[model samples]
Target: MPVFSCADAIGGGTEPNGSEVVAVRVGQHDGYDRLVIEFNGPIPAYSVTGRSGTSFTTSPKGQTVTLGGTNGVLIVMHSIVNWTSYLGPYAFEPNFPVLREARQIENFEGYQQWALGIQGSPCLRVTTLTSPSRLVVDMAATR
Candidate 1:
């Protein structure tokens, strides 16, 4: 198993060109609230950083995005292709114990951006899985 931390997690697959994001899902686990980003191809280069503000603005457009909780985390991925293939909602409010909401704020050019609203400060464990080719972000649930 990979280690978890409150610091930023950076790194992803070696898909030289680009990949399509097929699905995004959220679930509650025993010790963490999980957010899964499923891709049609290899996972793209990405970085997960905890944002300082609760409110965030969209890229390029500069429009404000509203999230449900007090803290936020920004996920930026490179070499993301075919945004039209992602049929899931661009925004959702799951309201889990730690992860409160999420929104795909940007999908322009070859870049994709997502914002997550969370409660408290949870440690993050980012893992890349095969067979399905997805990125799993696990936020530790507070007691």
Candidate 2:
């Protein structure tokens, strides 16, 4: 079993083609830490991959994202541009054993980017749901 919540979001989101990155949420479950991103409509293709370095830099733009953690999970949403700002007073990071940092990196050309600085890179799993479209991420709290 698991739980879900939309606890943090800053600067709101941008409207590109009438679509926006509606929310980024986090919650503590009995066995894992859960994260969810919501869209105003159906979700598009996305990827969640573990990073090998402490920071990630976007292509062509060279914006380096520094997230201090032993592990990193890069999240990219294809089909929507950022349409929002997520930095300074708007940054969202749980700073927990499972998730250390979360940010809205880029939202340009119909693509959105986010990252999760994680502790120890625990097992990561992903799922998608409709009815106000969401991408759910579950990271194991225990090895």
Candidate 3:
């Protein structure tokens, strides 16, 4: 393992007013970094993409955020928002080997954006799960 591992990228069109991001969690897997987002409503639609260095995630309302990282990844959920009403806390940077940080950038108009900073060439896989509607992101430790 190169310190990170991933299978494939995941992308889907997300709709507004579906769910909200309640919390973020990260754990070290066998060969990948696991990042999960807890949801309070239905599982939202989302898109994921890899980035280089600092990048921006602009909302529909012209809101943009510059996230930090060398080969960062972005996950934009259309059906969720980082609402204050949710009773969960977020861990911005767990300082994992592959996943350096998870930065919650913006929460506006039912849209939520998060950044996953990587140290090397990023390998990633995105997923959705039940039992409380969660979004999962996995990054590879090696090629």
Least well predicted 10-residue stretch by lDDT in candidate 3 = 1-10
* Alpha-carbon runs more than 4 Å astray in model 1: none
Q: lDDT: which candidate is best? A: 1
Error of 3 at 12 (Å): 5.7
lDDT score of residue 23 within candidate 1: 86
lDDT of each residue in 1-143, candidate 3, tens digit only: 12223433555434554566777888988777888988777777777777677566555455555544568787876755555455544436666778877776656666677777777766777677778878788887777
Q: How would you order the candidates by lDDT, starting with the best?
A: 1, 3, 2
Q: Comparing candidate 1 with candidate 3, which one achieves the higher lDDT?
A: 1
What value does the lDDT take at residue 7 in candidate 1?
Answer: 91
**Judged by lDDT against the true structure, how good is candidate 1?**
0.84
Residues 1-143 of candidate 1 have per-residue lDDT tens digits of 88778899889865645679888988999988988998878889999998665688898799997788878888889888776667767887899988999999888877888899998785789999987899899888863
- Candidate 2: clashing residue pairs, number: 5
lDDT of 2 by residue, 29-69 (tens): 77677788877765666667766665888644878878867
lDDT of model 3, residue 49 = 76
Judged by lDDT relative to the true structure, which candidate is superior, 2 or 3?
A: 3
For every candidate in turn, the CA RMSD to the true structure comes to: 1.6, 6.9, 4.1
